[model samples]
Target: TKKALIIGSGIAGIAAAIRLAVKGFDVEVFEGNSYPGGKLSEIQLGEYRFDAGPSLFTLPEQVDAVFQLAGKEPKEYFAYDKLDVTCQYFWEDGTSLKAYADLNRFAKEVQSKLGEAELSIHEALRQSAFIYNSLAPLFMNRSLHRFDTWTNPLALKSYLRMGKLGIFSTMNEANQKQFTHPKLIQLFNRYATYNGSNPYETPATLNIIPHLEFNIGAFFPKKGMHDITQSLFKLSEELGVNYHFGQKVERVLVEAGVAKGIRAKGEDHYADLVVNNMDMVNAYKTILKDQRQPKLLLKQAKSSSALIFYWGVKRDFPELDLHNIFFSDNYPLEFEHIFKRGTIYEDPTIYLNITSTHKNDDAPAGCMNWFTMINVPNNQGQDWDQMIAEAKRNIIHKLNRILKTDVESLIEVEEILDPRTIESKTSSAQGALYGNSSNNKFAAFLRHANYSSSIKNLYFCGGSVHPGGGIPLCLLSAKIMTEMVEG
Candidate 1:
């Protein structure tokens, strides 16, 4: 039997294991933590449960695809409900909007709430849909490098139409031109953070994210977002994928420009293929020490990390939905604080997610679980404790002002995740949520290829590699990597 060694048990690693095992390979995963699901995890605080990462689930079809590949019905292993109310927004300027899953209702809501042009909304979505249909086959479903980029006609069309992908202009620039309302613009601009990029700096191509959420629709798993990992783990286990918990891969064993296997916990395990689902940057600096490393890939601009606080509230608010956004007074200024100054903004745009709205069992009866997050710079030797202290005070004040409630007294439990801890735990470079920032126009192409062109039998799949981060993309990255292996 062919042996495939996976370096980490992150979501992508677990997905890759399932793919390879289903394809007739013997798979073994080595994880540093006792648990699987790197970011797609949960934390238990007192009597409350919260999804540690990816609070709002979107594009669940990508998740179901994995079960189908394993020759199983998705409903048998996994299932999710489509959200009717996608998200609720509250701005410091006293603008509130309810985002519905239905386009007509949403447009009518936007018109009544923000007085935005209804016609413009249709045109922008039509444009966004065109972009999604055009690029999904080329950029998302397949790897950019290899023989396909040269010979495949679809890839060639993607290459020719590259300029129109809207990478050159910023998202703010696109929406401002597409619509008349600044509030609508601000609402749409927030999509840049879906991949952990700043709206003011990231390419307008990121506008595609809104289409994915507002048009294609968002969802919530029956259990919680973390159930995505749990269901996939259950599937991987059923497929006979072996897992080693509390095991860390110390190094990638390279012999004469080819990957031999991985060195983990003072022992060398033999394998024909070494699939590294760890962060791409760390894969080079730590594991590929003996090989010639690409200086450009190492120096690629990284995406912004986040400072998140998981608060178990003692009460629930009726206004909040599964997803809520409390906008800062100056949205652009917040991005400046992260990208330009490399510092956390005092009044950052706060994202508040209450999964208990849908899954009330996540918390005690009459209470809520809040996953509050704000974009911050990647780890660069900042004083996180001090920054976190100031941010908490500011966030509570901001939320109280917008939500018109006493926010502080409701917090019954708290857990914080900063860049320093995220880096040390997940091995992501500086704890960047996505591998590289889409700050630059070419960032999509700049991510490390799914398979190494310079090294043989070495591959990558995870948030820190090509096709990008977040739950759906990470799963897609694994699918792309396994396809490369099979071919």
Candidate 2:
């Protein structure tokens, strides 16, 4: 049997392992951490359990398909339910909106609350769906660098409808043109940050993000977000994939410009193919030391990082849901601080995720676990200690003012994850959430392809490589990488 060695045990790595195993390759996954799930891991703070990263769940079918591909029923291994209320949005001006799962109901709610025309909402959604349908087949499912991708029928169709994608305008510009209401514009512009890009600079093609949440619908796993990692890891094991914990890969063994295997803890493990699930920048800088590095690709602008505060609250609020966003009074200035100033905005847009609302066992009785996060620039030698302290103060103040509660006093437990720590934990260069920012139109074509052009039997799968970040894209990266390998 052909042997395949995987470098990390993230969702993408595990998915790749399963795919390769199904393809008749003997698979072994080496994880630096003692446990599986790099960013998708969980944390225990006192009596509260928090999903350490990626709180929002969308495109669950991406996960379900993995198990189904392995000849198993997805529900039997993992299950999730579509969320009725996707998110609760709060503005600083005492205005709130509940984004209902139903399209018509959400439009009516927007009309009644924001005084925006219901027709505008419907039209925007229609356009978003169109962009997703047109571009996803070419840009997301296939390798952008490959000539066959552009020559395919799907690519031909996408090229014909390219004008509707808004590739020429920025997200903010397109949104401002679409809606007269500042709040509605801000709401749509927020999608740029989904890939950690500034709304003012990122191409409006990112507007397709809203369709995934509002149209396809957001979902929550039955057990919790961490269950996604657990279920996939379980499936990989059942498919006869081996896992090595606490094993840090020190080098990618290259012989005559071909990937031979990996050197971990002073021992070389040979394989027929090597898949790096680590950050693309780190993989080049740290592991593939002697090989020719792609300096331009590594030097691309990184996506924004996050400062997350996991607070075990003493009490739960009735108004809060699984996902909630507190909008800043100045949206443009907030992005300016992150992207340009390389600092966090004082009045930052806050995202609060409470898993205890759905899974009662996540926190102790009458209490809740809050994963409060704010977008900040990727690490660039800033004074993070001072920045973290100040950002925490602002976040508490904003939450207190909007929720009508003394937030600081209710914190029974606290743990913070900043960009510095995120980098250290996940080996993500600059602690970027996504590999690179989609701030420019060429970002789609600029992402590193799944297979190495120069090295044979070498591949990459994860947020740092092709497709992009988030759960759905990472899963697709694995699928794309495995397809490249099979060919």
Candidate 3:
């Protein structure tokens, strides 16, 4: 059996370990963090449990497939129920809408609240489904760089429909053109943020995101989101995958232009293959030191980082749902503040994820765990301490205005995660959450490849590579790498 050495124990690393082990390969995962899950981890503050990263859980099938491939019943290891209400939205104009899981209910909500054209909304949704269906087999869930896809009849048919799939126009532009209402456009436009891209600039192809959540479904784990890591780690270990904790790799060992293994903690361990779940920027700069750096790969734009305030509130709000968003006065201006101006605005919108509504243990009895986050500019040498302090005051004031309560006094415990800390903890370059920003339409084709054309046996995964970030794409990265290696 071939031996594989993986750097970083992110979700994709664990998935890769499981897949490789199922293929009868000897697998070892080396992680910088003592625990697995990387950014998708958790922290305890007194009695409160805070999901450290990625508050939302969508597309459980990607995770279940991993357990199934390992010859185990998926439900035995992981289970999640579809959400009836996807999210609750609050605009600055005193209008609110609940994004329902059922299309008819959601359409009714949109039509009643925004006075949107139901026919236009329905047609646009059908088009979104069409685009997602056409691109899924070609762009995602497979190796886009492979020559054989060009030859396959199924792939070729998809290739022909690619032009009509709407990848060239911006998401906001398409949604605005599809509907005549401002709030409705704003509602659909919010999907761009799912990948940490600006709706104003990111291509309309990203409209596929709403289809994934609303049309397909969004899920909530029976336990907290971190339970996802706990269960998967248990499954991977049960499959006999060797895991090295708190071992940060300094160099990717390349002997004669081929990957041998990695150098971590002043010790060199050799293996036949290496998979890096570390952020691409750090991996390229640190691990592949002797190799000629891919300047093009290094230069891709980074996604917006976030500033999060995790609070263990002493009071529960009956009006709030599991997921909520409070819009800023100006959506376009807010994006410009993050991406163009590189600063936080006084009127910054806030996203609140209260998981205690679903799982009571996230907070103490009678209280809620509030995962409050706001998209901010990636690290560019700003005064984050001052900025964060000021932003906290603004957030408290804004939430008070919208939710109609004194926001700050209800906390039993609180902690903040900033861009600087996110970068330090996860090695996500500039603290960007989703590798590179999709501000440009060409971003889809520009994401770093899973396996380099130049570097043999050295591959990239997790949030930094194609077909892009978030849980489903990260899982697909593992599947794509396994297939590429096995083939």
Model 1 over residues 178-224: C-alpha lDDT tens digits?
A: 98888888888988888888888888888788788878999999999
Candidate 2: how large is its RMSD? 0.8
Please identify model 3 stretches exceeding 4 Å from their true place: none
Instruction: State TM-scores per candidate.
Output: 0.98, 0.99, 0.98
Model 2 segments beyond 4 Å from truth? none
The root-mean-square deviation over C-alpha atoms between each candidate and the true structure, in angstroms, is: 1.3, 0.8, 1.3
**Over the stretch 332-354, how does candidate 2's per-residue lDDT look in tens digits?**
99999999999999999999999
Error of 3 at 125 (Å): 1.4
TM value for model 2: 0.99
lDDT of each residue in 272-389, candidate 3, tens digit only: 8899999888887888767877788679989999999999999889999989999887889989999899999888879999888998888888889999999999999999999999
C-alpha local distance difference test of each model: 0.87, 0.93, 0.87
Q: After superposition, how far is residue 145 of candidate 3 from its true place, in Å?
A: 1.7
Residue-level error in angstroms, candidate 3, position 21: 0.6
- For candidate 2, give the lDDT: 0.93
